[model samples]
Target: MNSRFDPSPAAVPPRGQLLLVSICLALYLLFCLQQIVLPFRFFGMTLSLGSVTMLGCMLAISAGSLVRHGVPSELVRPLLAILMCIAALSASVLASNHIGLACAFAVRYATSLLALWAMLSLAAACPRWPRAATLAALIAVWFNLALAGAVWFQWPGALRVALAFHPEETFKYLPRISGMYEHPALLATSAAMVLLLVLRLQQRGEVGRISLALALVGAVLALALTQVRNTLLPVGVLMAWWAWPRSCTSNRQRHIARVALGGIAVLAVFVLWLRYPDMTSAAQENMMTAFTLGRTYLWSGALDAWREHPWFGLGAGVFQFMVPDYTGGRFHRGELHAHNLLLAALSETGLFGLLAGLALIFALWRPLLRIAAERQWAIAWLILVLGLSTFDFYFPFFPFSMHAALAVASLHAGHCAPSQADGVSRSTT
Candidate 1:
């Protein structure tokens, strides 16, 4: 019920080309797993395998796509803005208190921003979007293996995540979750997005019921492990979408099913509320705590950083660097992120970066709305993503939305003809 229901991008190059896609996927998975499973820490610096893999994939994929088709100007603007923002952040760090540490993170930030855009430009106009989408789903499942393993390990990942986070009092406790993501918020957001894909598979009545069931159970467990309250909003959106009553009278109703998922959700919330009265406040403080407090604190910190360097506050990777200064000389404090995607640019790269991001988001809206109006299964997919982004960074969330962009491109390119996903011409031969 949520995403733009466009299947225009559901193309496959050819069975022969799947091999190329698979090799790329294998490399990406290795990076995600290495970052989490083996988390490297040395010389008081962390060089995560995940970020490396992420950046590497972005670069490789962007190159592959550009080689296939020249880079479009529409894509280049935002990408350059982000890069410039990173550069500014790096420069600001040199002026900061710790040149060494800021430099380290600056490198990391530079890598992430580049990798993100590369993937975006590369996939934005590719063909056979569904084939690419299918590949993405598999990768998501691979990443989610961590959540499954944690569930099997009998570890209360949910609790571990809560305790790990500052401004303490989170009490979410779910055992054996998280395939590899170290942070609960990251885990929750990713799980939510993957779950939407599984739901898409399940809706298709294709070869996805059993697999989707497994993915859903694992995703829920992982979300619990994250103990992230933000999961509620995205999950809530899904529930509402599911609950919207089916207008049996409307011709479009048969095209989609609006189950009373929200009612079920309300019932569940009521049950949880009932438990609160019988238990200590600590028993469920995770749910009791204000959900947006941490995000608010980080955003507030970002604002302070902006004020100091109104032009380009801090540096791209300088959020943490700027925190102490913003705190009025307090040392060793909590970290900060723009939290909201657009604001991240505003605070980190000043108005320049922020405008670029907004332009991209605006660019996406037209196509997104067109797809949404189509009311296809994919539309449901996008809605869930929308919910997921509220809590986590989804803007240029890459792998998650790459296929979506391709689908939009396919629609406009006639890739999704009434006849085929490949936009091929029929041959009697």
Candidate 2:
């Protein structure tokens, strides 16, 4: 019984719960992007209810805990703002051009945001959780990578057997990766994220580092082989953060590595784009097209939406609805989501909403800034670049935004770890 616990000033979590949530949020968005392309038939419904349930459970548990334990801080303001934003979203749907679809979107958004809020709050406040959270994320990535490998290796034969029953398609067929996901790019994206997180954990000397490292290397190799350019940014972002945490690792060497890696990344991207001319086309673009970062069409649509409604904007998930009505003939036939985060906000929530949302990031990020000032470089790097990778709608449908927000929040919450006796040193999940 050597383990002693205290919640006094000497042992408390500082409230950086949002940090873990942010990274998870990034993974969550990556997950959502993949989920959008499924054409499956489940009881005549193609949509995945699994995602809906997951987010719902997150929100429910968080809300339940909050009710049971209670919290007193300015943090509650953001939660209230999120709730109000959701309410405003409901109002927008009530006035939406397509009430039915908008309502569906609203349900999706509300549940996601609520879950995100709870997860971030809880992650920060919980005394014994950082390792558990890290483990949970690792498990998700590992599972996805395993599934992708199985699908990639088996797709050709599986397709042939399935095609024998319905050989009446004009579309060309190819055996590609699909992991546990509906699409190959998403699978690759998942692998890429897992690879980075695993590497970080390994670097930090977490358990299973070597095995996970080997697995991570394989995943990264496969991810690159898949050639999804959209997949590159997150991986690239993580690497930069991994290697670029202040002057901790000799600035001269770090600069050389950054330049070398940046140059190599650029060269690789150029080669892939050359091989696949029509980047957005499913067949023409190399598996590498998924990693490319030209999301102008979606961004413009978001801008047009913002121009129309700058105050409360189109109301959360209503951006998808606004996509068709606002921007015309510029993008793909049925594409939703602005590829860029800034553009998505400008289009969906407008100036005010975007500011409110970003303000949350800054508020949470400020503590990390202080940590960085004290030379806590890796953590700071994570914060600055988290939002740089993808455009996360404040929409509940996109889990990444909340993940990012919550992770940052958790880290900040953890700063007051004195209340838990020795805080970080004594904490476990």
- Name the best candidate (by TM-score): 2
Candidate 1 lowest-lDDT run of ten: 420-429
What lDDT tens digits, residue by residue, belong to model 1 across residues 1-429? 223333222322355546655765665455454324235653357655555666666677666655554445434444445655565656556564456655665566566566545544534554333434444555555555553454456467633432222113212333323444444555555655655554554444322344555656655555554445555665666655544655422434433324324433553465345444433443354533344544555666677777666665455555655656655544344344556654565566666556554555455444444554334444555566556655555433334344344333322332222223121211110
lDDT (CA) per prediction: 0.49, 0.50
True-structure RMSD for candidate 2 = 9.3
* Candidate 2 residue-wise lDDT, 200-264, digit = tens: 44444443534355546655554554555555555565457646755466666467448746854
Clashes of 2: 68
Error of 2 at 28 (Å): 10
Off by over 4 Å in 1: 1-25, 33-46, 72-110, 120-126, 129-176, 198-215, 238-260, 263-295, 321-339, 370-429
**TM match of model 1 to true structure:** 0.64
173, model 2: CA deviation in Å? 9.4
Q: What are the runs in model 2 whose C-alpha is more than 4 Å off?
A: 1-48, 72-74, 77-81, 84-88, 155-176, 182-185, 211-215, 234-246, 250-275, 279-294, 321-327, 330-333, 372-413, 416-429
TM-score of each: 0.64, 0.66
